[model samples]
Target: MGRRAALFILFAATALAVMAALSRPGVPQDRALAPGPRGTGPIIVAVLGTSLTKRASWPDRFAGGLSECLGREVQVTRVARANANSRWGLAEAERVAASRPDLVLIEFALADADLTDGVWPGESRSNHRAIIEAIRERRPDVRIVLMTTNPVGGLHRLKRAFLGPYYRVYRDLADELGAGLLDAWPRWPGTASIPDGVHPAPEAEAQIVVSPLLTLVAPGFGAVCG
Candidate 1:
């Protein structure tokens, strides 16, 4: 072919290649890219616990963190109360069963201590097991993640000492149930994750708990780590 003709052919091939690249999935286009896997459906995360979960800021922060990580809308429903226990969490789970959430974060370890008084340790375990079983029965496909509470300081330590067995029960339940566990205990000391030594601080909310928790929930959630 002549030089001019060859040049024209080369230009045509380049244009076609560019077009093909743009048309491929996940490739950015001038108009808009197709929705990613995360955008396929809305993720409903139900957080059940005590005052820590009730903290308006915690859920909001978690929502924001999940949104950033998943690159999709994250709806968080906080079914929590101040000074509540595992029984409350179980009730909340039962109520939420109908809603059919995509994920459930059980934050009742700290509250479980309260059950030791009225309920025996074995009975408390049974109650917690019943709750998990009920949730699974209601929504077989829903994912359950156990969230362990942060360690308490000073007087709160006394509560932890009493509640230690209950906390262990929570861990045991998670293991036996084959549920994902997110323990926020270790992140407390070195990092300033907890504000009043209970609820997560604003800074810690995004970095420590929110980001890591979502990452554990689903892969590729680490994209929101920054």
Candidate 2:
């Protein structure tokens, strides 16, 4: 095919892929991650993960944007620690559940893949399951979201050789446990460079993290273009 024809085909394929991704059934529609009537109270959001999440101003931005989009207040509580993994998160699951949030976002695959931590795939999987279970036990109506953050590269990538498997834990568990997933890993490289090989630069955060999440939870809200 000619160059122009090939470019057209690629663009068409890309559009189709995005459509397919968006069409996939996420958390139940009845739950509607957005808040209730105008008189109702704020939508409580709890974000639990590693430093990547702690640093991701996306949640605050998301809450603000979502509140505007849905015409309701969104209160966000972030419980994340640097260098922590799913194992550490499991210990705090009860605290998170006790907060009585309407929505919970979890991201820890990167930290779990740390070679120094040596949390194997199986153990990581179990930890995630336990954490989810603990939360669900208390708040059965909560809408949980699992996030796979930016892709790692350079020496950081080299160290976390099992990072792919670690990320899959979120995807698998999201399906198994009936949760939403913001699969940001595969979309990162195309969006921007992770100068540190782990974290996305400040400029890229809105696109790499916030955009897709906004698309997931609140469709039609103006997304941050990459």
Candidate 3:
């Protein structure tokens, strides 16, 4: 084959692979695959995220549900910052490590923003990795639970255009790092009762975030008040 033709073919294959690698139309059952500590006693869970972490009552909900399931104490410490990206999480890594949480649940809301040039996913990945490494250095036994952002309805064109790339990064990184994942967007109820499209409705929070967290936190422990 001619050299130009061969190069064209190779470029086409690479492009196709990149497209396939970056697309995540839906989530797989990866949350169940992540490793964590399912010990039989009291535990501390620290939630670090964007506004989603701040707005949702999932931490308290998880505590309540988990306590009921295990018949032991469950404490949730939230270290969330509104409008924050992964960089802030990286900066807060030391403090989070100091908190001595048994598990750190991380969710970065602005990682998918259309405004962050083309490097949002890459930046997010680096920040997340740095934070994870820092925390691990301080607390080798701590487990991390990485969660995907909740859905903004399809009508929200800005997010719909760019969000999947961020999701791709989170999903791939979770697998690569062997960290726990919670792909909460797919199961999220649409923006019905919520005031805005970004934050999930309360029912959606209970269904997607709270329930999955309860399952992960307690491991073998079963259902609780939702």
* Candidate with the greatest lDDT versus the true structure: 2
- The regions of model 3 sitting more than 4 angstroms off are 1-24, 33-41, 109-119, 154-156, 220-226
Clashes of 1: 0
lDDT of 3 by residue, 114-186 (tens): 4533246678788788888999999988878788766564445344446667776777777888777777755
Using lDDT, rank the candidates from best to worst.
2, 3, 1
Winner on lDDT (2 vs 3): 2
Question: Over 4 Å off in model 2, which ranges?
Answer: 1-39, 190-192, 219-226
User: Which runs in model 1 stand beyond 4 Å of their true positions?
Assistant: 1-39, 114-120, 190-202, 220-226
Write one digit per residue (lDDT tens) for candidate 2, span 17-37.
664453233332211133322
Write model 1 residue lDDT over 1-226, tens digit each, in one string.
8999999999999966664443222211111111223444577878777787777465677777767666678888878788877667677767878777877777766666542333556866887787778888999867777775565554544444444455566667777887777665545553244546556565555455665565566642324232
Per-model C-alpha RMSD = 21.9, 10.2, 6.1
Error of 2 at 76 (Å): 0.9
Model 2, TM vs. native:
0.77
Candidate 1 weakest ten by summed lDDT: 27-36
What C-alpha lDDT do the candidate models reach, one value each? 0.63, 0.74, 0.70
